[model samples]
Target: MRSAVTGTAVILAVGALVTAAMTTATASASPPAGPAKADPPRPVLVDCTWHKNVRPADFILACGDGNSRLIGLHWSQWGPHGATATGVNMVNDCDPYCAAGRFHAYPVTVRLDGPKPWKKDPSVEHYTRMSLTYTGARPDAFKAVMIYPLWD
Candidate 1:
């Protein structure tokens, strides 16, 4: 009977010690409660170079031949949904030939929308569509406003 009591007491003591140790460890291991670190800012646009940027001053529309481009971009808004800018659309006439074409600049209002994860870097977002409204004389045969699907 005495041995049984001693064994029970030993077991209870060991259990208490283990419980206290576990409580202390859990308390210490818990993360400190404070303001969480902010996530990195997502980009609104990806230029022809596949580089992410926000409110870029210039962007190329023609990645292959550099025939069309936007310059002097002044962004009015750059939010998660979309971005708006007023710039000049510079395009080559390609009158005689592409190599000898003359470049013309026209006033334009640009809108970037449909942001999606960039394939090259999933952590970053890039605009999937670009809409341009010509505020002045536009390129020949081109409409007053045009929408183009941006590269992923």
Candidate 2:
């Protein structure tokens, strides 16, 4: 009777150990209660070609008539809030008329700011304001520094 009692006790102890082991394994394998966090998406620039770009070599300021644009862009800083670049602003002289105008290049420092969700796609962000500070020569009717609103 004593041996029988000892055997039953050992069985119960082993069962308890097995149950504890399973509980621990199940807990470790299970996923977290809440949804997993995802990293923030990287911002992009929507160019005149209607494509997303990062540090584009050229960007068009005048999408309608293509009278103004930026070329040879060398971006020094591009972040979530803003971007800074050094480039040349090429504008049409429009001497006789726009169709027969000569394009001129001016050294410029470009700053892109006012980050907002793009109109076409809310998930994507784009710069809404662009500032141009002419370092050397400038356009005929323009100032040394100018700011323009970018299109979505």
Candidate 3:
């Protein structure tokens, strides 16, 4: 009768240990707190029509549409590798001259963001967003959102 009690106690102790282990394992398998991470957005490609072989008087971006143009740019630095220029943008401000409109010069700073993708064509490259931090001297009615990359 003593041996039978001892065997039963051992079985009960083993079952208790197994239950504790399973509880610990289940807790450990639970997902972590907070939201899951999402993938970052891809880099947008520069418009194909905006390519330039020669830097314009003002850096001209010949977009696919004839409406948009960067008419004049005086580059302090320019090359096949990279270039930086400061000039006025002769943009078609949908104002008095919608059709044969007068292109006005707005103060601008132009820069080369990185190296040219195409090796054969040295002058062509990418650019960054315009810094319109200008206060009083800034263009009239120029919105921060309206600014885009004037290419290299």
Candidate 4:
């Protein structure tokens, strides 16, 4: 009887170990937590051709996307050939020329549900023109060539 009980105990222990291993494998094989939020689809540029020396603006813009908060207007002036020109970010409400010569992209986030002209149509339908210039040794004039809106 003693030998029989010991054999049964060993068999039960092995079964428990197998069950635990199977459970772990099943848990790991299952998908992760919740589904990730997919990024918003890109909107077509309806009126981007008319704006000369302006960056191609994005329409489906959001407030807090992985890229930027609001829409950003970028401008740069290169040398004779296709040289690298200084890029500027013109999203601040203050003077556009406040941070001149800084080769950095500026972002301006606007409230879609705020007051004024924006609140009237808070459906991601807004536009603004930004003027920028290169303040380097050889300063070159360039306006916000593109206006990209955020989505998602």
Q: Which structure among the candidates has the greatest TM-score? A: 1
> Cα RMSDs of all predictions?
9.6, 6.2, 14.7, 15.0
* Model 2 Cα shift for residue 12 (angstroms): 34
Identify the superior model by lDDT, candidate 1 or candidate 2: 1
Q: What is the lDDT of residue 64 in candidate 1?
A: 94
TM-score of 3: 0.41
| Model 3, C-alpha of 76: deviation from truth (Å) | 1.7
Residue-by-residue lDDT tens digits, candidate 2, 9-85: 99999999999999999998998688878765656778787898778899998998999999999999888889999
For model 1, what is the error of residue 37's alpha carbon versus the real structure, in angstroms, after optimal superposition? 7.6
Worst 10 residues of 2 by lDDT: 36-45
Q: Estimate each model's TM-score.
A: 0.73, 0.72, 0.41, 0.25
Q: Ranking by TM-score, best first?
A: 1, 2, 3, 4
State in Å the error of residue 97, model 3: 7.5
* Whole-model lDDT values for every prediction: 0.91, 0.90, 0.52, 0.36
Candidate 3: residue 80 Cα off by (Å): 7.8
| Model 3 deviation from the true structure expressed as Cα RMSD, one decimal place | 14.7
In terms of lDDT, model 4 sits at: 0.36
Clashes of each: 0, 0, 8, 14
List candidate 3 segments past 4 Å from native.
1-58, 79-82, 119-152
